[model samples]
Target: MEETILVLDKIKKSFDGVSVLNGIDLEAKRGEFITLLGSSGCGKTTTLRIIAGLESPDSGRVLLSGADVTDTEPNHRNVNTVFQNYALFPHMNVETNIAYSLKLKKKKAPEIKKTVAEALALVQLEGYGKRMPSELSGGQRQRVAIARAVVNEPEVLLLDEPLGALDLKLRRQMQLELKRLQQTLGITFIYITHDQEEALNMSDRIAVMRGGVFEQLGSPAEIYELPRTAYVASFVGSANILTGRCAGGGDTVAVDFPGGTGSALRRDWQGREGDSVTLAVRSENVQLLSSDDSRGIPAAVTETRFAGGMLRISSKLEDGTEVVISRYGIGTDLVSGDAIRIDWAAENAVIVLPDSEVAHE
Candidate 1:
């Protein structure tokens, strides 16, 4: 069995009577990479701060390896945080900055030197120790901050959107690097980010927050394929949610949508006859075909966008419901006003409900 390294139990917090985290519960195993994903002001950062002991919850407990650390001071807790702003000492060189934490602990010169050298190499900045923060690029500075945080060998690392400052290309590269470092160091990472792609790419599990609580918690694949609510289906990825009514119940259930009717493989649905429901499908899961194919819902391509490897096609049905479809490669060139049809497999259809119904379930 995997060891549970961290646990947050019914954590509740409020600022001036305004609740930030309302009864948040989460657990993480050793060396697991967990991401707290949500939009701005959704309490993801507040949750991270609470875990790091930088902010205390108004109620509930924070446990590290079965011991309550809710009342522990920030420095006393077995956790460290890497902020988004790469908090580094402007006056100190890389070596000095990395060694500052160890030296403050009153370690001997030799021990500090050895540990700092290892930390530098861990982040692949072995020879850049003498460079000042201002002299380094944005990515390099971020690495230095990571080295400083990890040098002390904290059991859990809390990252608050640490890659937010870097450019798109550098941010993607650093995401991989951070995942590698977490694996290599065997430290549990509690990362906070609003970027859905980052969470999907790096985390073993994701806790999607909304309105001060976790809307859904699961593996990236599970969350994307089986979203519990319309919010989750729309937030985590590009999903086209269609209002529908349940037709019948079986291994494959029938759903009637405004544009068309379809069948979905039952996963987490409990709808009865005549009950209004919602069906969600990812844009990538939707298949676009020529109108003459004589299958699927008829739609007219309203927009064609070239997005790198995939072409995004926006189409509208006779009911005027717009749906987006992603086509890979350049097999068929499409333009606005082109006639097309879209369809998906039964298994690809996921039943997502309103937020309130999903929350109770």
Candidate 2:
């Protein structure tokens, strides 16, 4: 087995008696791009700060390249962060900013220049070395920040929403650039972002955080398909959840929902006959037909929204249960007041726990 480049063992943190992180255990392999994905105030930034030595964890250990660095100062640890605000020295030029850390290390002038040059080239900012921070674009400033961190050649790179400041197009471009950089450099990257698309696009593995704990961790496809928790399913993407009771089948379970509609079992949840369960289906997995009684019970159309090449048809069950269906090839006939049916395969559904997150009460 490959040794983990970074590990957080039994980490905890709290502020003003409100817990932000509750015993988080995570590991990062060498050169792996791991994104800490969650909404605002989910303790993602706090976790990054603790790992960087900027904040103290109540009780935990921070390891780097198999060395215990929990007590090491931010500068002493082999890690650096690129914050969202681009914390660049206002008075320094690009070259000076990149070489600032090397100067602090007391490296020779020639060595510092060479390292700075190499870092700038790595970030595709070779010719902009003499430009001031104020004169560069938001993306350029971010690249400079990245260059400064890479100039040190740290074992880990901590990015706290570094590309959040850029507009949509540039952010997408930078996402690609960052992925390429990680592949070329082979340094462990701990990126934090609230954008689901970015996390799904860039991460080798994602730690979905909510209520101060990791909800799920896996590859993008695995996390999307096999979300072990309800919060993870709803947070990562759009899901149409329906509540029902479990009924026994020969080898598989059957869920009989309200309005006499039954859906094939989505999971092997431990439940007795008549026990309540929530059945989840992704919008994309749902099948929509033009007429009522196509598959199961009739659904009353409530709203319709166009999403580029696809149409989102919203409907309510006979018991007023809301369900969303995503289908392709939009048509003018997709409007409210149309009665339809919702069809989905058994493999497309999942049974999830009602509890939000383990960290929550």
Off by over 4 Å in 1: 289-295, 298-300, 317-320, 329-341, 356-361
Give one digit per residue, the lDDT tens place, for model 1 in 1-361.
1899999999998899888888899999999999999999989999999999989999999999999999999988889888888889999999999998798789999999999999999999989999999999988989999999999888799999999988999999999999999999999999999899999999999999987889899999988889978888999976987666788878878876555566778876777878877778889989887887755777899998878798888999777878899878765577889988888888987888776565421
Give the TM-score of each candidate: 0.91, 0.94
lDDT of each: 0.88, 0.85
Q: Write one digit per residue (lDDT tens) for candidate 2, span 1-361.
A: 1658999998999999999998889999989999999999999999999999999899989998889999999989999989879899999999999999999999999999889989988998879999999999999999999999888888999999999999999999999999999899888999999999999999999999987888888999877887767777788876777777877653355777654455655455777778876767898988876563545556878999888677888899877789988877677575688877777777788777666324463
Off by over 4 Å in 2: 264-268, 289-294, 332-334, 356-359
Give the Cα error of residue 234 in candidate 2, in Å: 1.7
Best by TM-score: 2
Clashing pairs in 1: none
- Alpha carbon deviation, residue 257, candidate 2 (Å): 1.2
